[model samples]
Target: MVKKTIHEINARIRDGSVNVVTAEEMVNIVGELGPEGASREVDVVTTGTFGAMCSSGVWFNFGHSEPPIKMQKVWMNDVEAYTGVAAVDAYMGATQLSESQGMDYGGAHVIEDLLRGKSVDVHAISHGTDCYPRKVLDTSLSLDDMNQAIMINPRNAYQKYNAATNSSKQTIHTYMGSLLPRLGNVTYSGAGVLSPLSNDPEYLTIGTGTRIFLGGAQGYIVGQGTQHASAGMFGTLMVQGDLKKMSPDYIRAANFTGYGTSLYVGMGIPIPVLDERIAQATAVRDADITTSILDYSVPSRDRPVLRKVTYEELRSGHVELEGREVATSSLSSFKRARAIASELRDWISRGDFFVSMPVERLPGNTSSHAMKETEGVSFVSDIMSVSVVTIEKDASVYKAAKIIMETAFNHLPVVSKDNVLVGIVTAWDISKAVSQNKFDLVEDIMTRKVITARGDEQVAVVARRLDQHGVSALPVVNGGNHVVGIITSDDISKLFARRH
Candidate 1:
């Protein structure tokens, strides 16, 4: 059989004869007609998502004033904008916090206010020059006064993202929204099948230069987005568009309490059913896209995974966790997602828009690495004090207390005559021993089941162990279980402080 071409599809679209379907409709059609038959009938599938994207920002060019000052610094409604471009150009990052209002209002709010046609205070400063002598200017400007306004975002529309739940006793304020303590609520962010990249799993058609529906306006993919995970699965794209064509309804400013500002961007993509494989890919459902529920309480690159769940289960309003059904809420608006899909479908059916071929395919094997500390890794032996103030197990408590006071050490490791670590004594132990008039022996008041660290253990690992065990110090021991050094919280701080 001859394969259908994009030109043929465009011809049908131009003649008002093309069959376009929303992502939801395409799923049912593929189920009924199968991939081959659906590929022959369906010309396009429209997908969409409306979710918080913090990497979004807008660039503006203010018209020159009477005394055209080369703007060295610029601020819109007290939120700073990047003035590195030229005299009149500035870029406002969505997450840039408001200097006066803090996280409550930010650059994202400025963008939203501009889209709302509201006036904003514009403040600029410059070093005086002969041609442009104005040192400072403060005035109000609206979007209508700007020469060019464009939204250029580095990362948006993740294909799949993990749901978040707090396992710790305290609530966490994160970009995922507020995570309630002890899994009080679960929050997920993507629009599942309706998400653009989720439908186009492989960047087969959606790639650099491909036109998209961005904030209800025409936009194009620029490049691979930041944190664009490995292919054959999660994918992301950097997108840009003219803000003039966008509406405030499709793009809103959001302040994630403790996390800062982000843009709630509504975007859509039209997938051309060029072949059966493409048709099959677009037929993915909520149940097919899988992601895990992660505990954000753990402060580590590798957080603990609670459970893996399909989007279908998440969309069902509740998911089982720890033998109980937990309510789930989505940060992305499904209603708006459906509306974007429907609108994009109408645009395609009316021949107002045509799908463009990608200029180049995105890399399929790229993965992000965890950011390591610039100071580099330090082991227990590197930070541990070799001249450890040791207390003999048979030593009197009075002697131990005197040594601790003189050295100002909070903890002392009690050892045998052979220097084998037998126990650990803290200042609190000496205090209690002295209070009760029982200062006979150090071993009587010392903790026998003492935790120790190996000389080669990573400092971070040992530090975490200390935190978990509620201990301020760990005796560094060699292979023969002999105390070689001592590591305390203070020593760890000093090590990090020196490196930093």
Candidate 2:
């Protein structure tokens, strides 16, 4: 378990508390609690319109690794997080996910770092979930032509958009996971509109309790045709000049690629939190492995849910809130991204485009909870150790190193015959033990008050503390202080860097 400060926080700070911050007592902390640098959830993707195309069927061709793309999750000035395409083709067609399988960057945006520009997020996307791996950086060429070239490709990007397509309330309820009585601010938007084509009452709008913040603004009621499964069906999202300039491939991809699977577009208003409002969604998710695995696991076997958010409250992050500046930029940004996509697709004809991103080390398995795949992985059960070390209090340095070299472990637990963990003997501790030379027992050189991880706690929280403490390994212990397993920095490094 991560031990709290033994001294007061102020005292710890005075004695070099690394990056600890004073507790917040200001106005309510806005935004969800994201990791240090990854708190900022607003991402504005402005696809430029480019007119270029390539012959069909050159699928899976990574044209180059140039102009790497990236997404930034801005949290605090110093404590923020980011991730980008470390290596092109490392995670084939599957969407690259960090330990956390939350959405940050999707398609072409994945290659942004190589093509870093003004509009690119000021920070990293927090997780290097590379999707459309672009070419590596080509300093010899300009990014303008390169980006345009990529957008012109007709390769269908894997999107999880689940927007409304039919006037059928069924589609709305399915995607929204709830019911909205009206569309937008208009009265009777969902169940009220009559479809001329179907000659039936169309729930063309969102049902109750389903509030999707797509445009930069919230509470928008999109027309039926706009939300169809077809690309550009949601109408053109306004964006920069370049994407609109490339039309054909953009449109073709949209026409072929299914509308994204998510309920809404705004980044800040993450859907998982809102989905909990559907009552027992979390519990239902937990009960089934498949349900737990799906980031957007829907069509659950539970009872129906309803959306109860108001335009004002959702936009402003308040309930029954009055006169607050609604942060609809998340929605607005999506609209712009969509518009740019449409225009870019309109500009290009059907062909393939090549975007490039750099090759960073693929993230290895790590103890950081953030690194755990949201669905498949959860709490780390036990870190596999090549060897373990158990030492007596009087074990000599030579004996310890000899033991270490034999077992392939750099650290050992020092215990008495009674098996009480009194201290730890480490490679670093051995260095000390040797210098002192007079030491006869492991305790002579060991560090006391051993740091550890609880078996039941999440990995990310424990891993962060291990990093903060500059410790190489932590003992996994039970409430009774019985050592069960050990986690080393090498384990984390191997997990994240994949260097093992």
Candidate 3:
């Protein structure tokens, strides 16, 4: 049960004696040899993910022109690049859509073309300076011609993500992919066992400054990503690498019809077999990770949760929802993920790649808050029906039954002579009164206990009271118990429907 140092593993890799395996393989190894024996035998466990990463881009230092012009604006292959840096530096974001081709092409395509050794048209305009007299420049540039080309992503490799489905009557076009209406299909976006953060679980050995294989090139974790929920059920990281060493096959441009453009990133991480804990972490399986199935049609931050499912069920290609089996599709490429893991393992075995300790640890207790609406909360007064039909306490049971049938309402507020809410009379009450031959006043048959809501109260609070009381509606009352309006389940549904 000896803990091996990273240096000793690197030495073994140099001598071609290191035992390297993919994260998927580590599961069986740990089960066969147990954590201690597996940790001693295994040098590194490689993990990978190949998915659409929109927060990806490459910054290039295109060498200064003969009559240098500070690039105030830039476009490569019709895709705009941010030229706000220096005179010759520019950043091309993956999701920046092509101006001419719309969603069909973008800056991600420019990166892929550049990596493929193909030239791209570069156009720039600048406010001419004394040292740089050129006002504009139109030219074609290749990767080899750039002074420096580096891929720096603010976010990539999400640890875990929910599978999405549409529970409503309309299809939903989202970043998760198209969710067919009424749970026609489910879409998930993770490599399960091959996902880097899934294998690492806790930040453990993988964190800021850790070396990794980024888009076919060696890279380092820069920091916590935009939504790096470490205390989250899943984990994530931001990464950077030299684009000069990457290949076109590992990085490609993607246009998702209505969803604009993004980069198909190929990434891999090597987990050092330092201890039994490390080995056990690397052996995490798809069945162990769970994610919720969200109804994307809700169109709110608090989207409805349909169900919770494991990655193993997600990978099975279908999941059951609403008593029907719905087909599932993956937004991530498992084949490419396996290939990247295998390639990373080869690099570590040949001493071409080495793991590094994190420069900084990710915060473990950070939590996310939902975005609040700018407008004030809606109250029951706004949505309640003002023209409420009521039955007087002195009204006959036959009269109350007639009013309920004509309005198609299940219940009616029973009011006193001065228009104050006395009780509630339902259609069932009148029917029971008639069956008992007690065709007297409505108050005699009505339920004396009435659930009432104040008009100034929040709609959510009123809705909760209706649910708690197991009632379909609540009589909205002003000061002194005067019935002003009526709030019903239908009203709440309509309110949320409009908001969504």
lDDT of 2 by residue, 273-337 (tens): 11112111111110111100011212223322223333223323322212322121111222333
Task: Give the alpha carbon lDDT tens digit for every residue of 1-500 in model 1.
Answer: 32778789889989999999998999999999999999988989999999998889999999888788899999999999999888889999999999999999999999999999999999999997998899999999999999999999999988888899998666778899999989999999999988888787778889899999999999999988999985536678899999988988899999897789988999999999889888999999999999999988765567789999999999999999999999999998999999999999999999999988788987777887778767678888887888888989999999999998899678899999998899999999999999999979998999998888888778998888789789888988898878888899988888878867
Error of 1 at 198 (Å): 1.6
Per-residue lDDT, model 3, residue 264, is: 95
For model 2 the local lDDT of residue 331 reads 18
* 231: Cα error in model 2, Å: 23
Q: Quote each prediction's TM-score.
A: 0.79, 0.28, 0.75
**Stretch of 10 with least lDDT, candidate 2:** 191-200
lDDT of each: 0.90, 0.31, 0.88
Give the TM-score comparing model 1 with the true structure, all chains together: 0.79
Candidate 1 displacement at residue 168 in angstroms: 1.0
Q: Show the colliding residue pairs in model 3.
A: none
lDDT of 3: 0.88
For residues 329-397, write the lDDT of model 3, one tens digit per residue: 999899999999999998888888877768787777676666667966889999998889998899999
Q: Count the backbone clashes (under 3 Å) in each candidate.
A: 0, 119, 0
Q: In candidate 2, residue 72 scores what lDDT?
A: 28
